[model samples]
Target chain A: MSLLDIQDLTIEAKQGQGRQAIVDRVSFAVPEQNIVALVGGSGSGKTTTGLAVMRLLSPGLNIVSGRIYFEGNDVVAMPEGELRRYRGKQMAMVFQEPLYAFNPVFRVGCQIEEVLQFHTDLTKGQRQQRVDALLRQVEIKDPGRVARSYPYQLSGGLRQRAMLAQAIAANPKLVIADEPTSNLDVTVQARILTLFKKLRDDLKLTVLIITHDLGLVRSLADQVVVLSSGRVVEEGPAGEVLQHPRHVYTQQLLEAAK
Target chain B: MSKDKHFVPSPGGLRNFRKNPWAVCCLIILGVFYAGAFLADFVSPYSYQNEDRSYSYCPPMEIQFLDEEGRLARPFVYGVTISFDEFHKRNYIIDKAEKYPLKFWMKGDTYQFLGLIPSSRHLFGVDAPGRLMIWGADARGRDLFSRIVYGGRVSLSIGLLGVAISFTIGLLVGGIAGYYGGRIDDVLMRICEMFMMIPGFYLLLALRAMVPADFNSVQVYFSIVVILSFIGWASLARIIRGMCLSIREREFVLAAKVMGLSDFRIIVRHILPHTLSYSIIAIMLSIPGYILAESALSLIGLGIQDPYASWGNLLSEAMGIIQINFSPWILLPGFFIFLAVMCFNVIGDALRDCLDPHFQVDENI
Candidate 1:
């Protein structure tokens, strides 16, 4: 089985007295140990599609029809209790806004440790050691000090790094990162993308990165799926599609990135 | 990093709390009152309900150091001589011819200290029974000062207890309503509105009127607390629900949910902390309402019945034109009521100011 697969996924939002399809019957898959970028512009259902893989769409939004299979189990049909266990342990997510992602009261290390505590039976000392190691893996200079710090205390680059650390703390097989580097400047964005690449290669983590930045897609993605207004215009291997674009929209997207 | 410049770390954890002068003053006053209340049995000269008929309507004893022979003596008080006013109310005259010396740490009343320790050597007492009444005597000859001290134990404690119960309900109900937000919200918020629709005092009176009047004062006090909590929690729940409505949608809460934390855990650990800054302020501000509620119930003879001195029941003596004209000291309890409410209001406001997240963190703060 593919590590993560989507088949005929259709999601809808409730408009006035009607249901409007946001993500139409589009299908894609992330093979084991590869990076897949869902590339699209504003209002293209990129983020919504990413959330559907985890079955975490907002309350009003509905998955009209779909099957999201992580490993052999259908994520769409899994019960809440089982889905909970499946999320933090088997598949984790990092969002675009790291500052808002963290609980403000707790220290960065404490938040990271909470995940380990819930998902694993690790002792306090073991969890602490894991948190320190993960922070360091994300290229934090001093994990000890940074762990004790709050999200507001860290700069934007460091905050994203902390978020990445949290996302991979459970050693998840897959990480669905939604617009992970959209908020950072060019230099910091490049560094974060590099960090993602290293972690993916080192841990063989299947990454489904959602972004509108095609420049990032060019360098990082193995397979690029182009979405426009909730429909996939082009889906192919990154080099083939990047060099010889098949769709007009893809051409415009690539042209705009330059 | 350059981020450090803008972040300007707080010097110490409680720096904001300690730096506010009004908060510290309120803290000290509340501490002193609560401490005095805790030690009421030890510090008070008489039991709360102990009445000496001979000292009825007696003026407060004047503390003097002189004996009859022009010699310095121990602290003593002149005996009271009773007379009649035009209104037929008994008037008291301090007769210097007879003096009763004050004794310190002397055995007076036999009662439970803090309802735990069994001993009663009061802080100070008159050498003879019925010789002194520091805040004068009420119509029933009970010492006003002693009753006020003892009343503080009941009034202050009931306010705190009621708040504890109310806040527990508010946090859970508000949290669930806001976190879940559908039929549950509708049901809960409507129930909350039902509570809000009733006038708090009438609800208090109605609920309290149902309890058997034969129960002892302790039971009555507890019933009052429960009723006050029932009335107080609705508005608090509504406020907390509104706060939670906005907070539940925060990215952090969604992040916690996405991480597969059980809903209860997310509400308790992840969501509640965001509402804490508001909850704490709400708690402080609401305490005075509880205190006032208890006092109002007692003032109407519906709460902490006679001889179980709460500030409200104590001031209930001044309810009539006759009592006010004859004995002004019956209103003495009102001063304590004002002081307690003012302390909570001031401290609550100060806490809100200091705890405001919008307040720019500076070196002084």
Candidate 2:
């Protein structure tokens, strides 16, 4: 069974007196223990779709009609109380810019521990232990030192890893990464892709990556869903989709990628 | 590495403030007044209500350390004999024949120390018939100095209590309105606007007028505090709401929401705390307003009544030109009010400068 089934989802933004659909009838599924890349160019509604999956869409943006099923439960219709439980525990997200994502005032460890604190019943000592362990799992050298430093104190790569640690602290069923490698260097991006692969294989974790980077999809994604102007243009195995483009927009996107 | 400079620690931290000499001086000045107000019962020679009607409008007694033979002696003041003037106003003539020496820790009016310990030992007092009226006496023959000290308790504490009550409401209201923007924000902002629309002084007077006149001094003091606080929070809430609107858009706030922390938790922990540095500086500046509000109410006879002095009611004695001409010392409470307000403004300005750079960083975001 699919870990997450987003069927006929339509999202609208307020424009003048009428509402405009940003994501129109987009349907896709993230299978268990698989990496699904929702690939698209800018303004493709990829980020909005990712946010809708977590019900984290900003004000003025509304889910006009859709059902987001996570473990057979309709996420769009879930009550706030239960949705809160689903977030950071059953499903988690990592944003693009770790520097901005983490609270600047707090240390790396404290931010990660906040997720564990809310989702798990771990004691303070156990939570601290879990935080250090999570940091190590992200292949961060000197977990204690990195944990003690504030988000701004660390390098961009280290901050992103810390953010990833926070996302997986609750051992979530699915991790949604929104343009996670867009803000990092080429070397750091390669390492991050390797880390994502390790997370999928070792932890048996499902990941839905929202990005326009074809290179990232080629290296990391197993399944591909190509989106163009709020609609799904193509979907197939990542190798097939990248090798033989079925849609004109997909062909243009591949040309732009090169 | 250069980003480290941009993302420094707390902007309101005292590191910059301590280097500013004027800020330190203002802090010390405020400290002394607060200390005097806190220990008023023990520091003042006479109780606030202990008045000798015969000594009404008496000039300040000068303490002499040299005796008749020009030899050094304990501080003493001669007795003052009262005489009626041409206009039937009482005049005080110094009678050097009777010399009364002052003593420290002297037993005077017996009262509870801090409402915990029973004691009558005053810091300094003169013998009977020779009063130690340092700042002279008011129209009611009460020591002006002692009244100012006692009045400081009401005047200084009203500001603190009022700010505490108002800021709590302001921060919470602003945080909630800003965090969950939409219908809630519209309703709260309009309510805030309604409050801000009314002139503060008129609102203060109208609210003060609402309280029953027969309430005791304690009740009146609390009501006045509540009135000032009610008028005070509206503006602060509006400012805080603006700040939260910006802060709520910061990525960290969104991250907190994604963490599944409840709305209240996010508001208080993430959103509200980001506005704290601004709130604290604002609090320092606004305290003087509360103090002045209390004084204004008391001056108008709508605040703390007589026998229990506040700086405003104490200044009421100097309203007449004759009182100002004959016994100018009656205006001493006005001087204390000026000093307190000046000190608070100086410190608040210094804090703003110290935290100004942090605000620049925030603006960059």
Candidate 3:
């Protein structure tokens, strides 16, 4: 059985005049310990699809019709309380802008510890120790130092790592990273990709990496689902999809990648 | 490993605060005022409402003593001797020292300290008739100094209480409006605007007039606080609502929501904390305005009345030309009013620099 299954999902956002559907009949499944890359251009609804899976869509955006099954539980049908229990612990997400992802007022350690404290029965010391270890796992050189530092004190790469550390702190079954490395330098991007690969292998973590970069999909994703204008243009094994492209949009995306 | 293991102290906000001297100075001034207000009984030398007819119009005392040679000493007035001038005008002098030594906690008139502790410690000696007017006499020869102290108890406390009431209501209303933007936001904002449209001073006056004239000083004081708070909250609410509107969209707030944190928790923990630094700065800044408002209302005789030593009431005595010409010290309350307002503003700015994230880190740092 798939760890996460989305069947015939549709999401609509209320824009100026009428309800414009952002994600139309999008469907995919990720088995346990697999990395799936949802790839598309800006405004292609790839990110929207990820948000729908997590049920973290903005206020105006409505999940018009969708059935999301995660670990044999229908997410759309679950009560808010049950969904809350699964949100940070069962499924976690890393936002695009790491700088804004963490609260600037609080130390990075406290932000990570909040997740652990909320979901687990850990004491203050235990939570702090766990946060420190997670920071270290994310290749933060001085975990204690980074833990103590505010978000503004850290570099973009460091902030992204801290965010990743926060996401994985609760030992989530599925991790959704939305444009995780889009804001970083190319070199930092490579290192982050390597770190994500390492984390996935070590923890047997299922990851849904949403990005516009097909190169990232090629490098890290086991499977790829290409979205265009709220519709799935192409979906297949990452290597096969990239090598033998069926859709014109996929070819254009590949050309853009080149 | 060594690089990772090395100690790196998290820089403190104080280091940032030091970079702005103006803020530090303001903070110090505010600290002084707060100390003065809190320790009014300790700092004040006389009862706020005490009267001394003999010490009327006495020039501030200049300490004098006998020389070693036992000569009449270098022309030092001993104690104040109030008398009529050749023009039959009231005059005073330091009657050469007759053992009117400064005293502490000497039993005189009674006062309820903080509405709880009952004590009789004037911190300075009373007059011959047990009246201790440190700042000399008012129109009726009441202690101006005592009134100022006791007046502060009303003037200063009104700002805080008013702010407290306004802040609570404003935060709730504004927070709701900002968080849920749309028709609901529009409706709330329009209501806020409606409140804003009413002439604030006139509204305050209307509210003040509604309170029964026979209300006691405490009731009157409380009513004024409520009135000021009612008028005051709209501005703060508007501010908080605007803040909430922006902060609600912040990534941390979105992150909190994605973490499955409750709406209330997200609003309180994530969204509210962001606005607090600004709100605190606003509150501090707004206090002087509140105090000044209360003072003005009291001075106009619509606020604190006679037997109350509010700076406003003290200044009310300075309204007539004769009092203004005869005793310029009546204007002394105005001086305190200005000082208090300036002190609060400076302190508020300083706190903004200290607490504001934008102001905390200097360019050089």
Candidate 3 structure quality by residue, lDDT tens digits, B164-186: 99888888788888887899789
- Give the share of true interchain contacts found in each model: 0.64, 0.55, 0.48
Candidate 2 has a DockQ of 0.57
Clashing residue pairs in candidate 3, if any?
A: B48-B146, B78-B95, B78-B96, B78-B97, B79-B95, B127-B131
Candidate 3 yields a Cα-based lDDT of 0.81
Task: Report the poorest 10 consecutive residues by lDDT, candidate 2 chain B.
Answer: B356-365
What is the Cα-based TM-score of model 2?
0.92
Alpha carbon lDDT of residue B335, candidate 1? 91
Tens digit of lDDT per residue, candidate 2, span A134-247? Answer: 999999989999999988889989988999999999989899999999989999999999999999998889999999999999999999999988999999899999999999
**Residue pairs in collision within model 1:** none
Which stretches of candidate 2 lie above 4 Å from their native place? A17-19, A122-126, A243-245, B9-13, B127-130, B358-365
What is the C-alpha lDDT profile of model 2 across B1-365, one tens digit per residue?
Answer: 24667676654456778978988999999999999999999889999999989989989889899999999998898889999978898889989899989989998988899989999999999877668998899877889899999999999999999999999999988888887788998999899999999999898888887999789888988998888888888788888888889989998888887778888988887788777678889999999998999998889888889999999999988889999998988988999999999999999988887776644334245
Clashes of 1: 0
Better of 1 and 2 by TM-score: 2
- Name the top DockQ candidate: 2
Model 1, residue B286: what's the lDDT?
A: 91
Q: Is candidate 1 or candidate 3 better by DockQ?
A: 1
